[model samples]
Structure formats: structure tokens, C-alpha cells
Target: MDLGIIGQAAGLFAVTNIDDILILALFFARGAGHPGSTRRIVLGQYLGFTAILAVAVAAAFGATFLPESAVPYLGLLPLALGLKAARQAWKSHRNGAGDQEDTRAEPGGGPGALEVAAVTFANGGDNIGVYVPVFATAGIGGMTAYAVVFLVLVAVWCFAGRFFATRPVVARALARWGHVLLPLVLIGIGLLILVEGGAFGL
Candidate 1:
């Protein structure tokens, strides 16, 4: 309800504010790499990011149509998500989870919107966690902003992915570190929220 106050304080701008989508865009691009070498995978990265953000925007809008209870609970998201990412990354490190290259995204080599979408949808393994609750507070303005930022970030990541595939070892190293780094960073941020909420006796 207090969108203005919240937005200003949070520096929220709609679609752009969704850090998860942006991260997905970046990682997908980093791993996706080499459009010339692998067009389908690169394109798939793009469409996948777009679809997830679109769903997130819709969910954020839906929050408005539904209930005010949605607003307060938004605080838990970044922390919970961040922690989850950390756990997943830790697991992936142990089990080689992030190591799997998508067969569809690879796709014998071609690029099109539909192909992109399919690859994207395929990469959409954890769709719900990415789209839901966060968007629950997104209004129309937020959604549009989210979309624009998300798209721009995706474009940048895709470009990077396509451009830089020569150093496979380095890229993979960064990718592995990213899995651990991003989540911990996000989790720390979430913990900050708890601090501000006075949940702990200061």
C-alpha cells in the first residue's frame, strides 16, 4: 500500500528490481556462451529469462488484485531465496549440479524465438521459486521496470556468453564461484532485513 515510501526506500523500479531474474540472465549467459558456436543455447537463455520475468510481473500485478497481506511478507523472500541459492550451489558443487549442459539449449545448433522459448522453458527448472512471492508485491510500474531491467540484463549476459567461450576453464571456475557467491551475498542482504525488523534483541 505504501508503494511510494517503499519504492523510494528500497530503490525499487519494477521488473528491474528482481535480482533473481537478472542473476538467471547473467548465469544463463555465462554458461550459455558462443552463439556462433552454439546458437540455440544462447537464444534459449534469452527466452527463458523473458518468460520467467513475464510470469513474475503478472504475479506481482496479481498481488494488487488480491490482498494487502502480500506486502509485509515480501521481506522474507530475498533471505529465503538467498539461503536456498546458497544451499543449491553448495550441493551443486558437491554433486556437479550446475555442470549439466542443457541438451535442448544445445540443440544441434539453430536459433529462433520458439527454439529460444523451448530452451528457456527447459532451463526453467526452478520456475516457481524464481517467479512467485517476489512479484507478489510488484505493481504495474514495478512490473514494467522489472521487465526492462530484466531484459537489459539478459541482453548483456547473453552477449557476454556468446562473446566469451574461449576460456572454458576460467568460465567454469567463475560459474562455480558464482553459484556460491551470489546466494551468500543475497542471504546476507536478507539477514539485514531481519536486523532492521528488530527480530533480534539489539
Candidate 2:
């Protein structure tokens, strides 16, 4: 195992995924009233990130067989997701719900693992852009090392997010500001991905 590759992968994942901490923290705070929310969040994050990793691996291996140029256009996925989030937030505001997250509660009907996974995937679609290039260049050994480290770091991220939400100040702020910030963050991520991927010459 190359410690260099492992260290690099860990750092990259941690840096690129800092926004995930905020999202997870919101989830933790919102779901605090619901039992098993933490478990669902953990499972959902893993499922979502695994999908991203699978796509990276596929793109890496299929680089020769596929059009590499099309990879950048994959930014559309996040762009669409961000738009959808904005629409939802708008609808929530129009409906006078004030906060979408607060409006989603139900007795034993909180967001499921799949719901969280979907949000995770949408939020992290840009990971494909970053991961695919790294994976393609890393070869199988380095890819494996990156994957192991990334997954471990993901668990650590989840724990940290949950911990952050436990703070009274953070929890109150998230509750007050998270709905508005979430959509804007998603849109910003989409634009960043597009620019980084050189999509449409951006």
C-alpha cells in the first residue's frame, strides 16, 4: 500500500467533502427527534458515495472504450439536482412552511435511508469529475487504496457531522438557516463542477 496515495486520497476526500458535514449536521439535527435517524444517515451516505465510486471506477476502466469528452458534461446531473432543490425551497417558502426540513416530519415517517442517499448522490455528483481522473491515472492498486481510505473517511465525516449538530448554537443556526443555505450550496457546487470540468468551455 502506498501511504502517499492513501494520504492524498484522504486529504482530497476530506477537502472536497467539507460541505457534506453541514448537510449531515442538518440531517442529524432534524432527525434528532426520530429514532434510528443516525443509522439511516450513515447507511444512506455510504450508499450514495458507493454509487459515486462505482461510476468513477467504471469511467476509469472504460476510459479507452468511452468518450472522455463526455465526462465533463456529467456536471449536468448536479446542476439539475441543484435546480430541483431550489424549486423545492421555493415551494416551501410559497407554502409558508418557512423551512422544508422542518416540514418533512411525520410520526415514524422521517426520511428513509434511500432519501438521504438520493440527496447525497445529488450533492456529490461532482465527485465523479474529480474521482474519475484520479482513478484512471491511479491504476487498480492505487484505486483500491483510495477507495478504502475514502470510505473510512466518510464514516469519520458522518461522526463529525453528528457531533457538530449536538451543539446548541450550531443546531439552532442550522435549523434557522439550513433550508436557504442548502439549495444555494448545491447550486454553487454544480457551477463549480461545471467550471472545473470545463463543461461548455466554462
Candidate 3:
């Protein structure tokens, strides 16, 4: 209930998650006409975020017991995902109709919650790193307070993303470049995480 906790949590969530808005906006634009798309995206975001928080919680509690050397290797998760995405993007670019084909086929009737969750988790490697340190410093009460604020802010983020997706200029730009940029962004994040964590000493 401390105002300081709320402020810190809100600020961290907002600042650290700015990129999420663009990604979520792309999702919203892609699923524009699909029924239940909004619900699925929001649910998937929550699930993915919950997974990140779980990892953060575990690391914070067992920081001393866990091997710091292995932490940086976790970047591989996003790196592998980025490679897969790059392959897909390349294929889509090679085949004139490939992107359209992908658009028509939803993993489960329209970007099911699981698929979105996978992407969210893959994109959240940095979130886990940043959150672990914060959680490690906070007590149980403070952690709980931060969690509440974070969850609430997540909804706000989703709304903002959806709003952005509805804008004509934003929608067009995302539709055109999202596929290509997302993969590169993921790759960059992975490398950044590895370097920051001193993985491979680089």
C-alpha cells in the first residue's frame, strides 16, 4: 500500500514495456476481424507475463542458490525464436502469396492464446532480467503491491495497443513492416541480453 511501491512499479512497468505496445498493436491489427481476438490477445499477454513473473520470483528467492553463469544462456530462448521468425519472414518474402497464406491461417482459429503467449514469452527475456533484480529487493508485501499495479497497468497497455491499431496510419505501417521488424527486434534483444548478462564473456 505504500505510494512509493506503487510509483516504482508503475514507472518500471511503463518504461520497460514500451515496446510491448507496438507488438500488441501489430497483433490487434492482424486479428482485426477475428472474433474473440481481443480476449485471446489479452489473455495470452497475461499468461506470458505470469510466466515471466514466475521466473523472476524463483530467481529472486533462490538468487544465491542459482548459478549466475547459466542465466545468460537463457537468451537462447529468444534467439532461437528470432531465427525461426526470420526464416518465416524470408519465406514470405520469397513467395508472392506466402504472407497472405499465413494471414488466412490462424494457429487455432485466429491467433490462439497459446501462440500469442509463446511470442510474448520469447519477447520477454529482458523483462525477466529486469524484474528479477527488482523483486529480489522487495519484501513480500512490496512484491504483492507491485504485482497488483503491474497487472492493472497491463490492461492499460492492451487498451493502448488496441487503440493504436485502430489508427489508419499506424495500422498500415505495422501491417507492412511488422513481420520483418519483429524478427530483427527479437534478435537484437537476445544479443543485448547475452551481452548484458556477460554470456560467453561477450
> Top model by lDDT, which number?
3
RMSD of each: 10.2, 3.8, 3.1
- Every candidate's lDDT: 0.48, 0.76, 0.77
Give model 1's TM-score versus the native structure. 0.38
TM-score of candidate 3 versus the correct structure, residues matched by position: 0.78
True lDDT of residue 100, candidate 1: 43
Query: TM-score for every candidate vs. truth?
Result: 0.38, 0.73, 0.78
lDDT for 194 (candidate 2):
76
lDDT of 2 by residue, 150-181 (tens): 99998999999999988889888876776666
User: What's the residue-level lDDT of 50 in candidate 1?
Assistant: 68
lDDT of 1 by residue, 94-176 (tens): 76544544332454422344434543443332343445555565556654555565566656555555444334674565555
Candidate 1 backbone collisions, by pair: 14-142, 14-146, 15-145, 15-146, 15-147, 16-145, 16-146, 33-161, 34-162, 60-135
- List residue ranges in candidate 2 displaced over 4 A: 63-107, 187-202
Task: Tell me the deviation in Å of residue 175 in model 3.
Answer: 1.2
Candidate 3 per-residue lDDT over residues 1-202, each given as its tens digit: 9998999999999887898897788677666757788899999988988877777788888754335576666666667767877887687778776666656555444445775676677567677778887888897888888889988988999999899988889878867887776667667767876888899989
Ranking by TM-score: 3, 2, 1
